[model samples]
Target chain A: MTATARRVVVTGLGMTTPLGGDVRSSWEAALAGTSGAASITDSWIDEIELPITFAAQAAVKAVDVLTRQETKRLDPSAQFSVIAAREAWKDAGAPEVDKVRLGSVVGTGIGGIWTLLTAYDTLRQRGARRVLPLTVPMLMANSSTAAVSLEFGAGAGAHTPVSACASGAEAIAYGLEMIRSGRADIVIAGGTEAAIHPLPIASFAAMHAMSTRNEDPQRASRPFDTQRDGFVLGEGAGMLVLEAEEHARARGARIHAELLGAGLSADAHHIAAPEPAGLGVSRAIGDALRDADTTAADVVHLNAHATSTPVGDIAEDHGLRLALGDDLEHIAVSATKSMTGHLLGAAGAVESIFTILALRDRLAPPTINVDDIDPDISVDVVRKDPRPLPAEGQLVGLNNAFGFGGHNSSLVFRSV
Target chain B: MASEQEILSGLAEIVNEETGLPTDSVQADKSFTDDLDIDSLSMMTIVVNAEEKFSVRIPDEDVKNLRTVGDAVAYISQAQG
Candidate 1:
């Protein structure tokens, strides 16, 4: 509300996912309830003992999209980030802004785990001399934004904000604040993650946090279902070009949505679980609405961070009910991770993309595999069919992300 | 995996790869952007390649002057010094 927080707008978007390689295809696949998940076929799978042998792997591998040398130099996380960022940059018409006036903020839940695990093995077997010199930069948490900054010459600032699952949404929030604070005119913001390898899969599986619907990978991530076990691991990146509303208008850029507001809260109840009381989560939603200078009725569609886990899906439901109150039933709720799986840090960004699309297109995508709802939770779940938006006023969509460290983040995107 | 002269040419390859600067346009004394129009990414590639080819660490301060082939060869000479 202060002069430091200017109005930020979303101008361009890009995504790479299991549903499809491009934004159009991914959106269609998501709405149609097509799954991006499948059984792991890579030789890397043989090395780890995971409870679930399937995940929502990217429809297009980074190596398939990038040059072989590019794949060799950058980690999977960086590769996915580059692919999505290039799409967004190209989508933004490759604006020639001042390098000092352009900034980048990309966050990931897990950075270059592939590189870390691989390099560690190389050090043990092949000796330190054989390891690539670029390993450190490739594996660092800020690698995506760093690569993006170098590409676009964004010298003003390049930062990475990590908050577990909320990382991507937080990155977008940071970008909005940066422009509002007069630090930069334009920023490329998003999140990416590629932790589908044996190490992470085994680790997550060991924690009993992954869905074990191996035979039916497509139906594995059944969010909002009474029988829902856990989320399926996913790997991909989602990126957006954020610019000041005035700057976007001056450049005549295509406005996808307006970044209305963002709210952050800490549960402080558990390290890897949500507060059963849903107080902190409710506060985060309320905070974002207040930050956007809007009310509950403004948000027509809600992108819930329901990762199919029993506790997570219901906790978000309780939080949504508390935040929306009587208007909760009218807000179409879509559990995207049911189709795309859990993207970890990239989850918020990709889901934010989903939210933006719902606003721009006026259609809320469905939360697939709702075989048996509790019947007790009164929230209206969008399932099987995408719901149409109202014709009159501005459309606002909310994205929620809760992380392992008791981090809760909410972002509001309004149709421009 | 490559020779030192090859490393210089390989260094040139990095410049060309990232910046698309012409081979003939590249000069030893020329500043990367001032003369050849090399971008920051190209410079990063050059460092990555130099470390790979020569197995030497081109300190950040040393890379500041590495604009041309001569600069790279000289840096390698000094780093290898």
Candidate 2:
């Protein structure tokens, strides 16, 4: 850490998840133990034979929120990014910052799959001349970040980190770095994914990464449960407006929580599987704590990346235990994917928002559908209902996000 | 044979669907770029949809000449003839 490092704080949050269209509604739904999973309803679902028939679709449609002109120019993922960015900007009271000093970092696992595949289909069925002119711009992975950058005229730099599931958290972590390094006064950072299409579902099903509980959609994402099979694919966006603490205070903006620090690591083990011993994950947790200048004892709640996969859940548990040792038992571990499903690229940012809310309200949202807790999970899992935090003291929480290609990221948040 | 009114109304529906403008506002005299705020990409979409709906090939060379609803209607009428 540098002596001149500036403090970064979260001033605004916006999300459109399967649970709800915004942060408050999603947080409320999470606390109330609501499940957002359902069977696939697209007409194309019948054309493709997929082993998994269910997923967690966004609570609000992007078409309903954005104008036709906006939607026409932007892909679905970019559309979600723009919508979340606008909401977050508004939530931050539209701070008057120089365009040159503002930045944006939005991430995604797969960028504009719908546009790419549809353009290919159009070319094959119709002709080359029938392809849309904006196809390349829309299909690019950086489209979401570019759209966000254009939205706020963020010229500091528009960065897009594609770390699979950890992309969202990694983006937030990058935002923190940008602010601390004095590169930007404010940054719009988050993740957005709209890959509910048939191809992605088919691919995940082929990899056995998605749940096959077609008969019971809501109860399918049972993270840390003995009967858990796999994660349910979800689509949405999560965004946060991060500004320098001094800048936020100068503008009299309401600080939601302090973004203490972030940790990043990679497992050199497998392309898509987690390290059984969670060696890399533990290192990330320790690094995050150290970066935040916090101790294991400060962490009272954890928004875990427990995607309900049999192997992934156990690995995260082992990772937490290794990182915190005896302190892990005291933390209230909440598997928000139990409700929001696996939001892929948006998981980390959405879960980070949930973690920040958990610290602010001093309430831990429940991990729904944990009918029988897995004996392998040694931590105290908050299930069924929301749990209250310790009444009087400052609290810190951790949000862990691990992704394919061995990427692991952990963000630490402190109560305001 | 598709009449001029048919072509105009058909193009209006495509413009309305793409740009979310009122069908009534898509007059034959209104310029797609100046009046309807249609950009290059949207103009491409309009041309592609018009070609498919009217069963005519609108070459890339002719797209630059299309500026208003009446222009597209006349072009498609001549191509179909």
Candidate 3:
């Protein structure tokens, strides 16, 4: 941490999640403990005979929010990105910052899967010339970043971090550094995912990474519970307008929360499974607290990356216990993925937004479907209803996101 | 073979569908790029749809010669003949 490093604060937030189309509605549904998971009724599920038929589809389709021309040009992932970015830009009061001083970073675990698969299908069925001209651009991993960058004329840089589920948190972290490093005054950073198609669902299910509780889709995602099977696949996008503290103050922008710092690490233990002892997870958390110049004692809330997977939840518990030590008991831990399902790449960003809201409102959202809590989870898990945070002073919260290939990312947020 | 007026009407529909231009506004003298604001990608889409509708092939090289709707209509009529 350098003395001259600029402070980064969140000025705006936008999202289109399974809970709702916008941030407020989604937050409200989260507070009410509504489950976004439902049985996917798309005919392709039946055609493919997928083992997992349920997923958390976006509450609002992108076609409903975007123009016909925009939809024709962009893939589903890019469509979600553009929709969220539009809201976030408007939420930031549509700042008139110089185009060269602005930037965008949108991360995705899988980019334009629908586009790629569909284009291939078109080629196979209708021949080569029938494929759309924009297929390559739409299927690229950086398409969302490019779309948002073009939307706002962000010239400082357009970056896409593809670290699986950790992608979103990494993007937010990158935006924080962009401001701190004096590269950009404001950066729109987050993640979007539209991988609810048949192929992805089948692939994840083949790895036994998804729950098969098709009868009760709402209760399928049971984090920190004994009966938990696996994660429920989800689709959505989350975005945040991150600005330098000085730039925000100079422009009189309304501040949402302060992004104190981020810590990222790799496990190198396994490709898909987490390290049993959670050494990498602890290091990331410890580094984040250290980077934020704060101790575990100041932290009062946590938005855990409990994807409801059987071993994954236990591994994260071990990691949290190792990092926070005795202070872990004091933090009100909430696994909002029980409501939003596992948003994959967007999970970290959406969970970050929930953490910010928790700090702002002094209330932590609940972790639903924990009928029988796991005894191994020693942390204080907020369940059923929203829990109130400390009312007296500045509160700090942490959001963790771990991805496949041993990627781990943790972000710290402090109330203003 | 379709009449010249029918070819123009069919081409107008394809152009309208591809670029969202009004069919009535797709005049014979209107330039696909300057007048209709259709870019090259959209022109390709329109060409493909026109090929399917009129049952005539418009090669990639000849697409450049289709500067105006009148040129496209004339080309399709001759190709069909």
Candidate 4:
């Protein structure tokens, strides 16, 4: 069979999120409609006056799970990736595939910001002689990808797609392409982010892109609700082991879902705001469905990129209607960001895991805190409690992720 | 000026902090690369930290010559004097 014809399947899954430290815990919290956002307890928040005083910090600190050497050498971003990758690798039964046939792809929105800023401070205060030698390696955008590749001895290639919020989804798309194009037989793909620092929060606040509902952190991220002012900042990582369908079957690996196709597009409209009409979003969703050789009628669930911003949510709503048409009403759309908040670079990878789980569990998790659903949203959103899907059927789902730079990505998967 | 024994103990503490190798294991006779298993990056960290601790300058060119824990302690002691 041509490599293009080779099928890719998800064999393992892992993540560390504000909701929980691992995949199982996070998924459980998501299903229970628990919100991860809370008041900022970091001492740095007191040092600087930031408008937004709350965020969805990771439930378990990455440093607590990593070794002292690893924590010292890697920044928080790479540390999260390593932690998730470790769980994912072990979940995949720690396959013994050749190092040459394996690849690692990790995406991060802002890489090692903590390291860069701290190193710069050290340079000005303590002089150049005192700067740590490993600062550059830790601060680079590709640090997470390099660390993952080195950890697993992935020789095929190590890639980092830096497309802001869409970065994580782009990484998974690139991994799918790598396996299809015969570059690698197995790929570790995911997105990680550790940008909850004061500078980023302040920057987002300047753009009015983040919600400043400090009094009610849990209800701040209410996707498709009229009350949502903007997105909420969250930090964590999610990883998946994608192996060729035949390779997985040969090893008797447990399959989670079959990754059918991926679609990526750009708006070319504005830098920060999404294409107001969501033409780009529609194109991405259309392309993903077509690439999967499926139609809107086959899709049953949609894990939307609804970051709870008024404009973004309305635009995505329009995009879903344009692409899915009347079938949008049948899809149990869920915006788990209402619970986990927006994980930025890691959002896509984490949501993709949720989509797969929704298919596997035969239920769609609810979009919490939607006290008043916006009238503009025409689709049937799973709210209040988990919604059940058909227990027996060839179920298909889509996960959408959009970035600030007009980047849009849609991934399609099928129940195995 | 730090005595040889004092330098040895201080250097051991530095090595222990950097590599998690116990201070007791960082003997005067132990080679940094062989016995202590310190890599180049870690060696640089230890060198810079040791320089600050002893208030001495162990130039980069002189680092390769300091093969063992004893060599580093001796260099720091001499540079202090």
Candidate 2's TM-score: 0.96
The estimated TM-scores of all candidates read: 0.86, 0.96, 0.97, 0.97
For residues B1-81, what per-residue lDDT tens digits would candidate 2 score against the true structure? 799999989988888878889889999899989988899878988888888889999998989998888888999999999
* Best-to-worst ranking by TM-score: 4, 3, 2, 1
Across A144-235, the per-residue lDDT of candidate 4 in tens digits comes to 99999999999999999999999999999999999988899899999999999988999999999999999999999999998989999999
lDDT of 2 at A65: 94
Per-prediction fnat: 0.00, 0.63, 0.05, 0.42
- B19 Cα displacement, candidate 3 (Å): 3.8
Best by DockQ: 4
- Report, for every candidate in turn, its global Cα lDDT versus the true structure: 0.85, 0.93, 0.92, 0.93
Tell me which of candidates 2 and 3 scores higher on TM-score: 3
Please state the interface RMSD for every predicted structure, separated by commas.
5.3, 1.9, 1.7, 1.2
TM-score for chain B of all predictions: 0.68, 0.96, 0.97, 0.97
lDDT-sorted candidate list, best first: 4, 2, 3, 1
| DockQ score, prediction 4 | 0.64
Tens-digit lDDT track of model 2 for A330-378: 7999999999999999999999999999999999999999999999988
Tell me the DockQ of each model, to 2 decimals.
0.11, 0.56, 0.44, 0.64
Local accuracy of candidate 1 as per-residue lDDT tens digits, A1-416: 66456688888788898887767888999889888899999987777666778999999988789976678768999898889889988888888788898999998998989999899998899676556667798899999889889878998799899998999999998898889888999999999999998888888887888988899998889888888888999989999999989898888989889998899999999888889868888999999999998999877899999999978877888888888899885788898998999999889999999999998889999888888886655678898878898877789889999898888999999997
- Residue A164 in candidate 3 has what lDDT? 93
